[model samples]
Target: AYLSPGVSEHQVLDASYLASLLENSTSSYDYEENESDLNSLPCPQDFSLNFDRAFLPALYSLLFLLGLLGNGAVAAVLLSQRAALSSTDTFLLHLAVADALLVLTLPLWAVDAAIQWIFGSSLCKVAGALFNINFYAGALLLACISFDRYLSIVHATQLYRRGLRAHVALTCIAVWGLCLLFALPDFIFLSASYDQRLNATHCQYNFPQVGRTALRVLQLVAGFLLPLLVMTYCYARILAVLLVSRGQRRFRAMRLVVVVVVAFAVCWTPYHLVVLVDILMDMGALARNCGRESHVDVAKSVTSGMGYMHCCLNPLLYAFVGVKFREQMWMLLMRLGGSDQRGLQRQASSSRRDSSWSETTEASYLGL
Candidate 1:
């Protein structure tokens, strides 16, 4: 039932259709009775119930496993690279930590999905808070990484020695603070309740009218719009800097940033847009007619799938596009295979030479 960023729309629609088919028929049940039973329930609630029954537990199980392994490995690798902890790495470490925390909540979600939040009120609050906190923290850390890249490239000489460790720590604190503040509503609003029609107990949010509207608005701005704006601006400036850089090495760094930022944007933007639309629909700003409802349901299914897909994408991004990360991964693999380590040694030597050459070229450019 949770919306994620990587699931395909077709898969969601197919899942939904399959769920509907399952709920409506059995070899022994009469078609008329099945139709009558379905018609008696609220469409949205019935769809949600069916969807949860059919897909959510399995989906959460898969995500939990993926997130656990991927994020755990990311955290371990980032932590082990203590000597290479630049401002960029600092942000990345925080991002990995945030993502790992989010993964920790997945098991709870899986339980809730399968068994309808039998964990009670306190667990509900804790799970909801952790989920929101980690999600927003991850987003904020991504923005921080983008800004760090922008500054490192565009203001390289001036900011090169700027110690961002303390600043990054402070910013992380602020992000957590804001995340908690925003997430308080989830604590106050979400509760486990019994669904009378379905004869099932479940966890659900119960926002006051004003609070619900505000939460939706806040989600649109903080969760989607603000981060998008910041990432877009930083990457745009970074791209401009890269395009004009005289050094091939600098250009290469910029190109890497472009790929990272572009991948993030492409993966996340649709999910956010769909979330905004869902909020709008909830607020009655969108029509509630059958066609619109169907459209919204379809959109929800697609967006949720995509959002889940996002969780698996970050590790791939780091492994493939991050030159340092790729090197580290390759080294780790070679060690595991007990293969020749000469290639890694050669790469290290080549990297040192490249660094020396870059320094010389920079000195020449500055007439030093």
Candidate 2:
């Protein structure tokens, strides 16, 4: 269960009836007489609502465009491959699929942000569930990629040796299954409801207080901390091995791993930190006032947008960074233009030679 911008979730659940009464109050003189009694009412945040109206739609639309094009191209390229996939390729393919699915939900959110949840209750749950499923799936798939890289490079082993195809299929199935489990709350609790204060409909979860707190904690742990730990440990060990070895190719691969970790942290850290604060406030660990609520609400809105930008960055970091993938993309483009087979064969040979830094290290680029 979560909150959208506008009226704070804490305020919405606790004070909506009071807000409705105040909205229905007609006499200014009666309000003046009872002004002291209404002093404790949650303050209206015109700025947050106005910001959502102007800012969220534009940002969401931009994210949708960039994420769609990048992830779509990634999916197309990976799918075009005729040979069997390595473990890293399998992980990357699923990551692209998850990101593409997540991006598809942005247009609906864009509309919800600009206007209201006019799609009604059923679509609300479906969209919200899809969003949650893919968000968690992307994070888990990234961890899987890092773990697969760690095994191939540092341990000098594959994630599976026997029945490689079966293992890859099982891994993907497990990832999606876990994502669905994590997002079960959304499917069960998310619904489109009218926010009388902002005079707009919002699609948000309606979990009990304990459930909301638990879900937020789950998000912080599973979505951010676990992935961070796995990626950091895997890459740190990979870098250690690379540093001991002597080659410019190894150095370049080392730099790539560092960029991936840093990019993930930069894109996701602030949003999770904001979520932490939200949890604290909800649990009464932090003082909850309208001023703080307003600021956190706005901060969450902005940081979550920044987090979504990573969907656009993943293709660049994971796919385009690979020499083999780039060569494949070029061959794909050339083939579409009726290029000769001999030229394609020559380019493929050159790419294979150039991409071979080390068997294990090159696999990090999905070059295997």
Model 2 agreement with the true structure over 1-368: per-residue lDDT tens digits:
36222234644564565676667777654767778757766766766667777888899788888898999888777776635356676778899989999988888887877877889889888888888888898999999888888888889887654346788789889989998998888788888887766667878777678998898888889888999999999999988987787767777877788999999999999999989999988788999887887888788888888888899999998887776777688787888888998989887677555543112444434342
lDDT of 1 by residue, 274-361 (tens): 6676666657787544445555555565455456556666776644344555555566567667877797678656644433111212
TM-score of each: 0.74, 0.90
| TM-score: model 2 vs. ground truth | 0.90
Q: Pick the candidate with the highest lDDT.
A: 2
TM-score of 1: 0.74
Best by TM-score: 2
Query: CA shift at 310, candidate 1, in angstroms?
Result: 1.9
Clash counts for all predictions: 12, 0
User: Model 2: which residue pairs collide?
Assistant: none
Give the lDDT of residue 253 in candidate 2.
76
Reference-based lDDT, each prediction: 0.60, 0.78
